[model samples]
Target: MKYEFIKSHEYLFPIEKMCKVLKVGCSSYFKWKSRPISKQLLLKEKIKQEIISIYFASKQRYGSPRITFELNVLGYKISRITVAKYMKEFGLRSKLSKKFKVTTNSKHSYLVVENVLDRNFEAKEPSKVWVSDITYIHTKEGFLYLTTIIDLYDRKIIGWSLNNGMSTKETSIAAWKMAVRNRKFDKGLIFHSDRGVQYANRKFAKMVESYGVIRSMSRKGNCWDNAVAESFFKSLKTELIYGNKLIKKEKMELVYVFKRKWTFS
Candidate 1:
């Protein structure tokens, strides 16, 4: 190690002086520098390059384990620990997902329904239970609000809408309309959401009631009651919105593209 260190600094300092200062002999330093790179060292360099390539290809979202798996799939036999060591040597790290904030506006005169969903996130059939939530995305223009409706049976985002404002007509209602148009539901289908004003407002209530669907709301200040919707938002932020900047127009386009991808796949 001392000879290697002296060799690395030989260009900046006299080789003999560096070897003496580093407590390594000049002969040893020269010998080490003249020696051919070992096969293990060459392989380590190759693995480091592959790890960097895979890390950026995944948008820095893959840590050592996933990168190791991908490397193995690409015919490179490697271990997670070795990958982590190389990543540390190169100061490479996966981008961590940012925490998303809850956007429920429960302070309103609108009626708040009971917590009928009650943490029951499973549905036996399609459209039996639907969960919805609104979350805000930061854009250069301003904040864009996204409303999403998920079918609990398949955990698929059935409908979604993105707009500059969180108005009922533009946000929740638009998403609800899209979901209704896309899927046929039975009479006893449950629509669950946080007690946000948009969901609890009379207009939204009337809209759902007209379809003979039962309304279920989370208890006051309780986000876990609407865990499915919250989980969806967390995924959306982590996978799509985190560490990226988009204007309102671009954000809308992204939302449309994502919805299409989800719808088809």
Candidate 2:
């Protein structure tokens, strides 16, 4: 039979109290507790810690399979199944993607500007042409609407905004402000976008006009006209937005993500 001892009993009758409570002698308990850890046990503990460190460093994207491969690359010889068992013990798993849809209001009476871009996304320099568009991302909360303006020359996203609702003010004005803050605009600099109400809105157009930038818009129902913006949205959605789970939609979300994405470039 197994027995447990209490500290209160230790002060009562010494060995007699311990033997009565524990049903084992204090000397035997001390000998067992004082035994040094085996070499094999120490090695196993070290390996377990190493595996845990690697698992967390991967940002939880890697399950045991990928972790096993990564460990091998790092000069660790371990079985794939063993890694899987470790990951399961640690509760590590990959994220799953959710479905998202586009929300561009093309059906409006707003005057569509000419397709000045003409599928020529390249620019000689920044501010010569800026392509803007809005894309949607799915998050656990709901749909996250993203608006971005990219420099045609460098394909760099100069400005962006993220919000829970698709409002005109939510898309263009915030991005325009960011762009103006980043770089000075010159006369004849073309600001191109699709015929969405956000771009065609009088307030947005006036803002662009104030900068002396030409307002260029895609033709009705034709996405190819604003191909630069379209392509940027496609790449962004494919590479980043689609894979990320939207926990909360905030203005600074895209800014933070883009900063990291650009760093990797």
Residues 142-244, candidate 2: write the lDDT tens digits.
6778788888778887887777777778889988888888777779998888888898878888878987898888777888887777766665564565445
Q: Which 10-residue window in model 2 sums to the lowest lDDT?
A: 1-10
Query: Candidate 2, TM-score vs. the true structure?
Result: 0.59
Measured by lDDT, the strongest candidate is: 1
Per-residue lDDT of 32-58 in model 1, one digit per residue for the tens?
788999999898788889999988876
lDDT values for all models: 0.82, 0.73
Global local distance difference test of model 2: 0.73
Which lDDT value does model 2 have at 21? Answer: 65
Clashes of each: 0, 0
